[model samples]
Target: MEITYTEAVILYCLKQLKGERTIFSLYHLYQGKKSSQTIQDAHLYHLTPFFQAFPFISREELARQIERMEKKSLLDKKSNEHFILTSTGDLKLGEYFQANTLPPKYLDGWRHHHLTALFWERLSILVQVCSNLVYQKKSFIPIQNKLETLDWVKAFIKKRQEGRMGLSSTLFLELLNCFQRDKTIDPSILVLRLTGQDRIGLTSGQAAELLGMDHTRYQLEFLNILHFLIGTVSDEAVEFPLLNALIPEAEKPVPFTLSTEKTFQLLNRGYTVEQISRIRNLKRSTIEDHIVEIALHIKNFDLAAYVPKDKEKRILEAAKETSAKKLKLIREYAEDASYFEIRLVLARNGDQKWK
Candidate 1:
């Protein structure tokens, strides 16, 4: 018998379904079981909800379909509540499924696609070049070898806009800073910024500023995009594990005696100020203060010996300049790192650590 697409779809869902009830629910009461007085009630109860959501199949209609199938020997009626498809049914269903699906060539990207891997691998190069455009809030005018980079930027933006990218607005805005203007940053440069000594990961709030949207809206939008990027189509909700990795775990403030050592250890372990607060039962603001103070001390310590002195000096200078205005300049700088980089020079410095 020729298998219909509808039949194939039903079979696939049935095979993949978990739990006895769900399986029993999807399948029509085939076997002589539904005719039995004892099992008939159970079949009707399970069948009701399924029918409502499905093609609104009536019990009479389903019985007729089952009878037809059985007559054709496509299904075997075992007991009152149980029915099994014959070997022909299995073969026909498999054939229909295979016929409906495209060849492997059409699914080439699916075999190796992972959003986090794609983002991390592409980000360093993409963000560095796009930083300029982001800072300028201007579209990339492709020239030189910048076309590929701009194309990537366009694609990334499109994905975000379509809710197919799981990035937060804070992250989106942070990303925009990299491509804001005509800045042609190398991927290595952006990578360095993320991995630098004075490194701080982008926050959800900061990401909101980047997208020019309110934090709450951006957060929802970002989560949806993440869902799309992660390829989830479940009726039940799922969270991406990569999100936890994106931001460090929150950390509590340590006293000065243990601050430096502890901060270094936590930073290496991906602990954020917020994480620290929860861990230490301290306030977030207090933890931030401790982290800032410790960071400053690290900058002051001839740990300059461990780093490139000139680059360190330049970074210190930029921080000093940004700090002078403090609030406004800091916000501006954070909002547009590509623009801030010229005046700031430390735009992509954090990425260096990964190298």
Candidate 2:
């Protein structure tokens, strides 16, 4: 059986989850929900690489995919909202990936999504401008709409010592060198989306149709390429100066949601959770949610600050004993530990420390 790219992604996620999670947990993961449970689950399951990889996929659409997969005998319905992968499904997944490599390994969407998006926007406008300039054509509309990007392009180009022609050449050569270095990646999928002097770049759907690939597949491919470029450029910035310029700041471990970012700011200012809750006029539980979110992303966060060493040890032990990610399940075994403490432990260490 030929498993499609979309099927392959879902299958990979299901396998990682191992039916311990509800089907909708997959939905929330893709939707990139900011809830404490979803955020902790994304990290705990080791599925952070694909977090928010399909934010636009509707729940109904996901159900349809599951139904079709069930019909194909790739999924076994263990319950109304949970599924287990069949042995045949596992074999098929292995075969499918052997034939097609994808769902890029180092996505870090939970970490670099915002940075990736901004980098793409900057690259898009730069490409558009360079294309028009190559044809000696002016008066073309900018591909990027954000005022920040527009101003960035103006400021970026002005600051460059190279003239327009030299800048374009360097940009083109750097991109070529980077893409050419990776034989597994087909750069055409990405390049086809770039607007050139002769034509506007194709939309994602258009590019997918042209490539005879699924829309989801095309998107994953596109994102993988961006991540690939971001990684390539970051480490070799001196080699790809123009590419590195787009990512102006040192990347944060994970991009925080605005609310969580506010929480982080307070933590940085040496404010206690109770103090922040009162200052922000939010519930204590809500502030706790922010703290858990902080634990999930901030590597240096001291777990002992809120949780005593013994409680932390108990929670970790329970997670190992049961191999369960569910808070209720862990709470049952870790009777003395609260749900919040369990979450903090999971967020801090994820699956790595225990399992």
What C-alpha lDDT do the candidate models reach, one value each? 0.38, 0.86
Clashing pairs in 2: none
For model 1, residues 1-355, the per-residue Cα lDDT tens digits are 6854445534443332212223344433322122112122222122211211222345665556556666776666656534566777667767776655411111111111223233433443344434443444344432324555546655665545423233433445543443342242222222332421223335556656765644433433433333233232111122333222222211212123354356556655778667777877877655544443344324333333233556545544545554322234544434433222222232223212211
TM-score of 2: 0.91
Instruction: Estimate the lDDT of model 1.
Output: 0.38
Q: lDDT tens digits, residues 64-122, model 2? A: 99999999999999888899899989999999888776457556667667677898899
